[model samples]
Target chain A: MSGPKPNELIEKIDYNPPQKGWMDVPVKIRKGMYCYASNPKSVEYVHLPHARPWNPLEEDWKLPDNWKEIVHNAFRERLDRFRSFKVFMDICVRCGACADKCHFFIGTGDPKNMPVLRAELLRSVYRNDFTTAGKILGKVAGARELTLDVLKEWWYYFFQCTECRRCSVFCPYGIDTAEITIMAREIFNLLGLNIDWIATPVANCYRTGNHLGIQPHAFKEMIEFFVDDIEEKTGVKVEPSFNKKGADILFVTPSGDVFADPGTYTAMGYLMLFHYLKEQGLNVTWSTYASEGGNFGFFTSHEMMKRLNSKMYAEAKRLGVKWILGGECGHMWRVINQYMDTMNGPADFLEEPISPITGTKFTNAKSTKMVHLSEFTADLIYHNKLKLDKSRNDNLIVTYHDSCNPARGMGLFDEPRYVINSVCNHFHDMPRNTIREQTFCCGSGSGLNAGEDTELRLCGGLPRANAVKHVHEKFGVNMLATICAIDRAALPPLMDYWVPGVGVTGLTEMVANALIMPGEAERTTNLRGEPLPGMEE
Target chain B: MRLDELLTQKKTAIIDKWFDVVADTYPADTAGFIKRQKDPFANPVGGTTQKSLTVLMDELLGEMNHDKIDSFLDPIIRIRAVQDFTPSRAISFVFSLKKIIRNQLNKSDFNDHRILAELFEFDLKIDLIGLTAFDIYMKCREKIYQIKANEEKNRTFSAFERAGLIKELPGSGPELA
Candidate 1:
């Protein structure tokens, strides 16, 4: 009775210099007297003239009432089905540690984007739906009804989250708000409330078994296209590992790497690396099926997760490959390291991976026995199997930006870096928390692969770019290297935004470039110097 | 295959039938009695033909020493007190009142008919407004009903976890991670 009213508990005790007097003023009084009545969207409208992929409607497209009921019930069922991990993380203590940790919050100074508050919006609902206090006192107890408005708010903000799980690593309770964010998105998605940027790919993946929605013919065409690109760029007569059965390794990478940006270069690198391995009599078979590995739907729902992941296993079974290898994608590995075993199977199709040359068993496997390509390459280097020139990478100052999935999600902090340092002599680290488990995002992860919302992307990318910028300012880290495909897809555009001259490259790309050609001397030019196509000159 | 049609077809019918049965059994005259009882100018029950509640209200009034009902005894509280003081008799009274109100409700056909039914059944011990306790109670009741209606949802996630859709993080617990 004596304390601040229940509604006032979340009141801004901390305020800016001008608002000290207003902190204690009840929200009712503030609203009544025309206080901070400015619209939030006005800032975006005014500041971001070029923000493409604009949302024209506040409300999502609705289905018929009967259809709406079905959708709502389906979502409710999914909500009901959430595991302990879902419940545990949704009950986060509103600690501000994650607030400052978020790049979007730090860059834009928008309190709504702060990971802690972003989490609280949904956490309040969980408390209301599941807790005793919530049952006894409504909003006063920080429990609000699940109105259409709240769901819409969740759709907007949670999608903005990127499921980076960067906040989760720092949380005292280890609350991964990313999990809740994904769940919220999944619920919205069940109702067919989809945005074009992320959802189109998801629907594509569902329909065509790949996010790019490449037809089976187009998928094969992409491989051939990349092979030709490799021939043109590196003068290597590269061949795709297409439909080859019973090979020692079946390599798979993010399809984006095959189709776009620096990922295309990584795709080229994989081709060259496997070509090198092929010349060495390594009996490896690799092919791209509809990319079921890094399904954006994994970020949405279990149904989608099942639909997406089932393809890779199903494909692997069809091809009768001995082992499957995941390419450099962040969340794909997060799924592989964290969810794959639980999501899909005994994986009878996937044989335990072994070194093609050494025949040594890959004994220490993560949740799913599938090996991250970086981990495999790192192991190859550790065994002193890779013949390389460290000086070939000397032209560029290299720094490692650890992909979250491989580093924190899969506890693969050292392997990729070890491989990088082994292959390249000038390996450096970005500022603290820029590598390993504490890495920042490329801003376009978790299916935020949209051309619109570039402002939001830049805002999220600021923290990461700022870190890379510090290295560029001090040690002159000219080329940023990472292992995940999403990072490869995301970081290049971000580098262009903040530090104009700096570039991003995948670790495999660098390794492939430095790789000693079977017959020719490895002629590494300004290896990190020449601007790759699509990169700023 | 459409989940809404399945749930609505089954759950909605069950809820409607239950509502009708409960509505038919609730009292109609209680609201009129409460209205008439609260007026100070009306004759106080005394001497020969006093009903039990009339005597009780008289004593309660004497205790409060007021000609008119106190503002502290708002409509909800007064109604609750009257109902509480006449527990055995109140059940019969409420049923009679429900019978009278059913025809009117049918003619009106409001979407919030369920709200009225719930409000009518609310216990005297419940303080509905102190902190939106009424809404909270309703939500809790709804959640419980939801769990009952779709029992599979409550267990599927855990089963999936065991099935390996989500790998539990290290160190939380068998359930939490």
Candidate 2:
């Protein structure tokens, strides 16, 4: 009846889509547009509430007859549980400040990716069920019954959000979209409508102690593989501790660091750093039981997050370590900084994390007693404790990508850069808006990193990739150093596809490359085994 | 008689019109953002437009070589391949050139046999370039799917490995052994 068909050629776009009625707009679930249903094994492993076979693209989702009431009850329960969820639901004035702030919206031009609109997808549901005005006036009041289509829309858009909280920074009221997104996902979990990428990991981390489901032996062997590769690259053999009792510190990192490419190199960075610390007689132990740092359960629900988060403190107390040092990760930092203490914390058993070498107490991390790897490195550099050779990175003109979790969630902007600048001489910033607090997500954050939904991930990653492309062309920056493990795993392919020739690494990888370690071989290549430019054997 | 002359002479007008079509692909506010954008970082979708349009205009004027056309077409097409645009919508900008050329040429100009023959040749080249863009667009979509497939394999890699589905080199982890 109106303009072009959604599939037709470009015409004028209505940016201000009518606020009150999204039900009038049909859901566009195209081929290659949605992910497969959760594997029953993954769902059952977690013993999630509602367990039934369903597919997103199928005509019949086989929803329980009371699915609508289930959603309403779950929403009311969440609203009662979290005040922030209630506030986020109640307060959006719909001022479009966050309209263009999302990487997904910028990349794909999807109106639903707009943070405000994405929130409104759920907010509309809130009005339909609980609000009195919504009950009285249907579509006019922006309230529609919780139909199957509406539930599907919630799953599509809510999963699309990385829960990056970039919109929260720009919101005038400080209404976090991540709050609503987490709550929505929690409600989805209540119905057993889980995605495989999330559910499998949740089950894996629950049972085997890591998301990758690497058994204890395999987890140890994976690191040993990295240890061998590290020795091949640097000629420095390392014997990292595993589940050691009475160690001074407990070293924890995302298992992605142990399992994947590029991330393995960052894991090598941690090994070499820990090896150096070990030679200085500092005892740091790695635990297979608390193997994961990046929390997939955080993507699922708060209770699941608490269940997963309890491992770190439990393992720390069991091992009798004084403190914990978290390696490069994004969401892990957000969980550690914002939620870890309140959820399963109060680590009174452990002392405040003081750098054994630097003798500098991490006064800022006083409560949780967890220090970031970059902060520890920065302190060591500030005291000139490590012999750093910035010239080792002469071939690389690097730029720092502040991963969203650490940037906005934890305010960890300078520590990683301080470490990068100390080791790498040539470094540049992407742009003011796209860095630090305004950092874009890797698009594959949370559990959306699964291969089945790769296009969506790439769409969300466009803004970050575009920003990297700008610096690569303008500043001749060929290296992207980040503090997040997911960025290390995700940004390599992102850089390869969007802006070729740009390499990605953790800050510590660059540090290890620049480190003039004692009894190490002449450096000819970076940790990835690529021949370092300007240096010939 | 020179058909390319009509397009070359009206290059600015043609490009200005083509710019409108490309601009319409984005939201109106985004279109405004593109118009005002000088920094490529701030507005990359807007930034790549002028350089690409200029090359297409030059290709129409001179020899319409695939390599020449490809140099400009690949970047924009690859970008749009991952964008919200469908395959047809993403490459529709190529055919829009025909409209501009057809509008600029008068009826009297087409009546001359030489001009008509040249016009026929020019139309063929545009058609050829459209075909070329279609290939690039499909290849890009394939690449996106390829990446997705690779990632999917990786997601349950350990599961597969544990299930004895993935073959290993046997000596892959000699150090661990």
Candidate 3:
């Protein structure tokens, strides 16, 4: 190809003639430089400070002078929705407690992942604009003003924070620095400035109605893949109800669970459970049209959150499911628990999810008859139902890892543990602080699991890894279990980086492993619904 | 006695104790001084920025060479300017009320009440109270009033106990306020 296009550093020279005695150099280099595409040079640069000289007398430095107001207005119009300069300054306390909470901090000891330091990049600008001290004194009391340069820096670091509230749990004032980070990103997004990774998912959610960018057909294919997996693993052919007419349950899971690690196995468990329920003549008609329950829009803005969640509710209504089931995902539960009620509606068809078999009722239901998969499964098991083969999961000595969203955000602390304990005999609790409301983020929960925030994910996931490692060392926790699909997709990489041998699996993986084969079935098969190759007893 | 009743009694004792300490520092009529201390924004500091006297004083005096002016006269003018600052006087009035409340209520007894007091320090010390400031003052005032309401409830409950009006401690009579 064009021999790796020429590396030329193009420097803009500001020509300002001195009045007779000033320095004889006519050319003062400006701040920005664009290298010519044809020129071959080793040094490549953009917005290099030394590349250009600034002259106050030059019209280029003046606003509405260099770029037309139309272009400036366009950019400003986008930034209008960004967090107010005042609001940003008001939120951050810079306590440095968030420093240790970052996976990046724990992984590489990079001080930058410390949420406090990360936020200072934006907080400084707020101080400069709105605070008197910042106007006079710079960087002393931790304040700076937002310039165009600072805005760009905000985009860089704000995106670095994964909006995981792991740090916020410990904050004495409950100051969520992630809020500031999201605001910063939203501001950058408003200015039509977007990183490819965050923007792509946002765009996908906007278009296909899911973050995976998987169309309805592809999403259905994924559900069927899980069906095939369940059939192969157990011996039941489950047609995952898709946009089915008047289905009783619309089973929604984070798409990551269906496609990626620990979650795929969890998807298998879900299918197997439904198959068993169907065999018992339970009216559990589940569909996958509203397959993706993850609100990736949470990573962007409240408006985006509303749009995504509204789609989920509309689909649930369309499918006519009495209850909507959310799979293991962090921020999805946060949206489901905290914001969905106010944002979406008083969804009438969905009651406080009554047990279809036991006739037991859930008391604390709001927004919708929203039931977590773990709760649904565990409760069934609790009530002497969901015939489980406990011995089949003897291969694992499992310890449950409470994903923060379900634990802290939704108070779903018991259901997953109950399910694991019922199926697996080797269930052990992590340290008190490390489970339930105080559970650590898998370091990479939220969209930080992607390529862009790898460094940040590594740093932020450290505390979670440390907790897991402690459990592994003490209890020989060979298998770490969690209910969230995001944890399944995210924690494996974190485990690889921090604690190598100890692996993470979905609680349902443990369940699917232990499901008893039917004796009188037409085809007593594995998950694929075929005759067993090796017949025992 | 119920734990809450005991806890309330303990709170009254603690408030009395704190008042004793403050009484040693100044007079009980220090209500005037406390009132003076209650200005919410007496500090004239806003935002997360660091404060500098030179820029602020320069703005007040309308003189750039405020530094060249006699330093002694500046402090006097600034102090007087702050004293005359309408907000600071209002802050003092509110602060006197807070000190009164603090003197009466036990800090350890009510964690929420103590937290409210500490938060109200911004109002009491600086005199920056505005409409929002007034709302806070009224809220604290209501809390102070509730102490009496709670005392009356307790007295009635205690009398009921003595009179055998009710047997159990979470008494079945009209629940305490």
Candidate 4:
């Protein structure tokens, strides 16, 4: 029963890995660090290839006999298809500027999680197959053959990236590492190596028009349930229209806000806001067919992204809405801003988004004709359209977490803050480095927020939670507000782990808490039924 | 001088060495990065380790308030708990403080009998801290499992409600079934 000697203990705990070249180091797939393999049914549902049962932990991945040929052909096809992919694959000088910028690398301390190394995992393969020197000189030329182990390494590391593009911000060449991850994921999908978290949602979204697969009646019922709750809470009954034609705006949000906790509260917030606007003669309709704003297809493949994203413009045309208003979600906006117009546009059928409340033209969204909810709300607040009593949110010392897609992908920094500052009395920003374009990931973006990978999520969330912890200690900040539904679903558990006592909410939820409707009840509790600041007695 | 007085004089050095020992538990490349980068937000693992070790050392020498000691040990142990370390290796940093203290004491002439007694008492405190760290580490691991279980339950709960199996909505009392 005796323990080892002190020196023996120290010797046994040697975590300093031996000095080996990066190529020689083997990939170690640890439990709790990786996700379970995609369900084959989900893969086959989407008609993706190689839809056989395979586990990442096992040695035999059951890859096709010509898996190498499949990858090589797909890599070449993508190289021809995307000029950005070609440039990104050819460009990285490995100056190590993006090495420490990745939250996974900073939190987990895994060299492979470093954006440079994560891209190198794929870049080395690209060089091996495409470049002459890599083919001739081999390992000496910083390239290696694409063996089964190398493919396994690619699968393990590429999924580790959230595709937040924080590394691209620091790279001198502005090389987007996320595009490399997207390409790797595209290749992964071809081999049916998609994680269940992404593949199942993609399949569900393809079939049911939402990731949760909520049928039309069930989707309506969920909103009606929220409507009932809103009526009880505010004594103001709000009517929500579904699939109605000729509405001015078609509202779409991630189904997570309808099905998930805290996100359900955000959905209620949207209901209240829309109800108040309806009284003011603003007409908006929710669509059961294009019910989801968040796109899991973006995490699956480019073609799948387009396939799922096509629903928005198709529904907008069917409903004949002037423009679309997106709900709070992360990668959904990335797809809309970067790829939606190119892949699914010209969206010429829809009119440009002009705020009826303020008559301000959203010329920024002239191409895609979709306006973000923050921009829409901020414009409404600027024109004093809605009466807001900020004291309702006096219980909260709020800080905004810039969801990576809207912040980095869309440069949506000020609009959400402008809305929060208008809605809440006490607002503080986390360390200047951790907000806006430089904001940290909630560690669950790009469909990495599966339950089994809780350790990975918590570790990736460390830097973000650390920043929140600093502000919590300094300003007693209690609520972490965000505009993304994934952030709404993810940040609660992240805060529960890293910095307890802090809560998560969406900006719209805060606005709904502060919105002073015409004939509403005297509010005692906020949206979550927690007592307000002075109502705790 | 007495052992406590001598330890007080070398407190800063001890804490610095202790932080290095914890950092060494990571891979060499990560260890170097954590040691070199001093920014708390940029390098949270390094910052949390250094900050906790400083407070932990003071608590170990001073009144050893249980709450203060637990608070300081919580952050470091919580991090290491999730990291790729064996359970023994996760709490091993606690025992390394003994080696660091011994190395510091060996350099100074502390052969007096009273100093030896104080050293024995201090070692007991180190053992207590190690046990506390084990508890904290287990707590973090349990919390992670609980979070995972709750996540699965939350998803299922929504699905059940959507399927009309659960009659009661959330915020109402428990389901009758």
Candidate 5:
């Protein structure tokens, strides 16, 4: 028999460096850590520079000969476009408050996943190129040259971030690393360095009005299909209106919800809720053209985001709708809350979103004239408009996973909890440290939610899953209820692998289960046909 | 005293030594979480590490009678699997327990024949636990890779299905429009 094979008992990982003046350390691009490159056609469609097929693992990335100049010019333009970029770049005092705040760092234990160090990966390059102190002292002042290796390092680390903004919540100066990541990704895209995850969605949404690239006719067909599923489940033959002119409200949700499993169930919930509302004489319509609410362009660049976001308002004006109702999504709200009005707003043609049923005026959305689905549903429950049976969800021991964007970016926490609690009796909160403003990412946010980046997603996802696993073991929590569409699609596999037996559901799905729609058949099972407690004979 | 009685009496000490050996693998701050927090929600990684290590050591020192070694080892090994440890490094803590037990027994009863035979039997049990840990560690890593592949396939599921690459078959639940 072979004697004990020789290896270090303690792992050898000396690559992380000192406080400053340490720029020569080579970044290790281990397999299963980074995302695969974007498709050439996707990059080209978005008009990104140097759009060609490239692999992250290959020796040659095929970057342009003048790539450094192009990246510098792009950075300089962003420094002009956004003042926050300059503030985040220049104003970090390197306080360690945000270090332990990142779920990525908590999960991977790589110092680079720490928001401070992740930003420093790009900040070092910024100092080398633009800052006087960095130019004078070189690596001594925590600066490094923009070599090809440095570009790769920036790409690797930036994509590792979900741009969840968890660290910015704790920053003393309120330095947003999401701002830095968005800018870095834009620069990477200039040289056609894009992950297929983000690039494909941006291109698809630009071309087909949604990320799934469902053509106009096909988009209608998808909803019609969901309508049939609704009839089968709820025994309500409710026809949904699509792209009809003069509709009062324009509803748009993330395209992923329309196309993916579990997310499809959330989409079904929206249909059932809207069907009941329609039967009550409220007039709303979905637009085939502005069919998506999520902005993958938010991951690519702000300008790209504006291009995708303009469609929603344009569709509202085209359909002659009064206001917009955004469905369950995370980053969509971050854009709507912070960027939409300033970017493409006044939305002068649309009236403020007054709930046709509850008569609640959404004053917070007065400027953008858009209301979140949770806020709408919560108001419905508050005004005692909908008939909800709490026992429908008695089989589920539920907990809410606060999606990162809505949590940190908008502080839209209580509205979702309000909605979930109104519908389900079994609501539980994860540990206080891991929820609300300090919420963890679903690991695959922004464009990093793509399949090829599964390992990175799973690694980054561990902290969130570990938290869920905790509640799973402690509270006998069988279902993880969330409000975001991405969380619905992404959290199931996360639960399956990291914390088995804990299922995932959207708040709206739980709402649909509990909603006692008038003239509807007696409920035998919740959404997805899972048997209700007494029905499980 | 009989070797079985002597072994039974020292079981707590043996288990405590094993607990220290594995828990010491993490940083002090991380180790403190296990030492301090009993609530799993407050500290899951630490909680699993503490609970699983306790059960693991008990199994090794006792009759080693149960096939439920996996129930104890899997939780601990799963965490170690995702950590930045080499396969050898992650499983080495298992082997370290053998050294500690040998040193303890050697000091107490070096000359007794009956105790030496019992010590040999106990050392064999420790070897089996180490092997069990290695198996669990490999399974965890494999699960991670399998999950990544499935997610990648699932994320792009509808796109391919739309292109007629993935066809609809009955009993597959709803169709992708």
Candidate 6:
């Protein structure tokens, strides 16, 4: 009573918040949460609309005149073209089943990050412009006009989503919120508002046939460097041919594998695996034209995704390979599995992918005519083709992280695990809910894995990292095995931050570590130059 | 009973209140979800907060082991460090415990001179925990910046190496080189 009342003391704490509807609150675009704006050159390179420089942090976004009409027409056209789009916009009941499912929502504790509310951000605009109830009732119908503030809110939350489809899994209506995010991103690109992480990669992929813009020679030189690295580790040289005509199979992987560490080790894994198959007369060629397997264009727009993905079949046809074998990548397989045949295919020129060593036909990829590396390797293991020494990986207690696209887009749970189990001695699943279809994203998927937005990536990664921390503490899981190149690139820093002492690896890297190639010297080290289990001095 | 014995007797209620205060730092909707969800993996932010507060309460009553306190504080502070919290607000939960203890002991039995002296000593201990939390919070913030800096450097270094601009990646800093 003398110093201060209890109520005043409680008031000193910053717990009370303003009582306002979410729509009434203005968006506060935080730094370190969003990526920089796309460069004009990159946007222009891809011939996307409204290719002017703009920054998200600035007040003026430099939108074109008639920007509202542009958005209206685009929204109407998409609703008409994609029936699923219209259906999704109409069907959601806001039951909140998917509210807590989003990793971003769970990690950031931002209300708008909830799948129901994030969709409602766009749905509110849709209700205003597209629905009769919205037109009549306005605020009562939960409808609001699409102002510049609304557009900024759209850009912030849509990009925040990794399109991991975890929310869609929990939705009672089975509405794919990733598609909603995709539609929002496509509309954003109409105004040239693409993030630098996405626009630069799309531009590079369109021009140089890879996200890094590495020319053909440089691409080959990078692979040759990995060959040198593989030779140094295993004392066996792998001769991976590029652009060679009449090869039996053409191999394509993400360029991140060539340019980044950890992924570089995975690239070496592919080299050793292919080199081992070379002795058995398995002729596979690497194509510089389709060098990238992960499509940043998929994150940009549908037409751009098709334009970049067309190169895969085109290069495979030109090389005259019987079929194509994709490398360890996530969205790349999602594209091939779900959209490739319909988008660029009738790949009638390519044959149904059959494992040259196992003599097993890949009926799953018969239509798309492209086989996933995990599926092909799993087939090889089932056929008892490659001799493996599991003890080489004894240093690692491995847990598989199912990449979002491969887990949800395609039901590819068993193949990667089968491959991991066949090669590595110690394997543990993170948890029942966090693995397979319910697997959490590495949080950097969909071209959001830029350095500037590391905090966002780390925050979004906490749920996945938290699950990994549990297994890490319980089972001493040291290596996070994934079939995703982005995971190789992203999860290393994630593990470094949240759970130190754990390493990120690709399934192929594990396979190569355990692979006992014919005429190879006694292996002293794994692909990362870490000494093998018992050989570590 | 003694101050430690009384605190130990009231441990569950103290921790429950402490957890509520910490959870209230999140938004109302989020705080509700955090309190509602019991599973750690499904609601890590809530689970971590509850778990950290329980351990911190036990340590506050008992040995006040700095290492055990830091370890529990790590997850909660690490979370708040990335969330949109100011540094003081991020570690304010530790201080909030002082108010909770005072309110819980506000009855006449606890108002004796001896108990009031003991309460002063206990408040000092909470202040020590607050200092430790500040250190943990700063370390987590530093780690975020470090991760960001390292990622940027590695990206550029790899690109440079690929272009043959540099023969070798540099060490952690110029001083290391």
TM-score of chain A in every predicted structure: 0.83, 0.95, 0.77, 0.98, 0.95, 0.98
Best by DockQ: 4
Better of 1 and 5 by DockQ: 5
lDDT of 5 by residue, B18-129 (tens): 6666656654434443456565544455566667766776666566755778877887787667766678767877777656666666565868887888778877887898
Candidate 3, position A205, lDDT: 63
The candidate with the higher lDDT, 1 or 6, is: 6
Candidate 1 residue lDDT tens string, B1-177: 232232234443333332333222222221222223332112111110123223323333235332232322222221222111223221232222223233324334435655454435422112222223233334433432332233233235434433345544311123320
| Each prediction's TM-score versus the true structure | 0.64, 0.90, 0.60, 0.97, 0.89, 0.97
Candidate 6 lDDT by residue in tens digits, B68-122: 9989988999998888788888888888887888777748846688888888899
Q: Residues A1-537, candidate 5, lDDT per residue (tens digit)?
A: 665434433224221223322254567786766777888999888788788878888879998999888988888888887898988899999887887667666665566777988899888888988899999998888888888888888888898888998888899999988888889988887788878877888899999999878898878877787777777777877778889898889999988788887888888899888888886667888888998999988988778999999999998988899999999998999998999988999888899889999888999999999998999999988998888999888888998899988888788889989988888788778888789987888888887766555556766777788788778878899999888888887887778768899998888988988888878887787778778879987
lDDT of each: 0.56, 0.81, 0.54, 0.89, 0.80, 0.88
The interface RMSD value for candidate 4 stands at: 1.2
Model 4: per-residue lDDT, tens digit, A389-432? Answer: 99989888988899999999999999999999999889999998
User: Model 4, chain A: how large is the TM-score?
Assistant: 0.98
Tell me the DockQ of each model, to 2 decimals. 0.01, 0.31, 0.01, 0.72, 0.28, 0.70
Question: Using alpha carbons, what is the TM-score of model 3?
Answer: 0.60
List model 4 lDDT by residue over B1-177, tens digit each.
888898999998898898888888877778888998898999999999998999889988899999999999999999888878889888988888877898887644566778789988999999999999999999999999888877877777766777888765544522321
Query: Model 3, range A1-537, lDDT digits (tens) per residue?
Result: 544432231122211112231111122212211101111110011111112222322434322232223333433443454444335456655665555555443333234446676666656655665568877886675664445455444544565565666677777767676766766655543444444444455556666756556667666665676775555544567655567767776777777776554566677777777776775545554444455678766765677778778877888777777877777677788888888887887777676677787676765555566877787788788888766766656546788788877777878888888889888778778767656776666755546555434434544565566667667878878788887777776676667655668878887767766666464243234332324334333
Segments of candidate 4 deviating more than 4 angstroms: A1-15, B107-114, B169-177
Which CAPRI tier for candidate 2? acceptable
| lDDT string, candidate 6, A359-410, tens digits | 8988988899988899989998998999999999998998989999888889
Q: Pick the lDDT winner.
A: 4
Q: Can you tell me which runs of candidate 5 are displaced by over 4 Å?
A: A1-25, B1-47, B63-68, B83-86, B99-122, B152-177
Best candidate according to TM-score: 6
Model 2: residues with Cα > 4 Å off, grouped in runs: A1-22, A532-537, B1-13, B26-39, B62-68, B100-122, B152-177
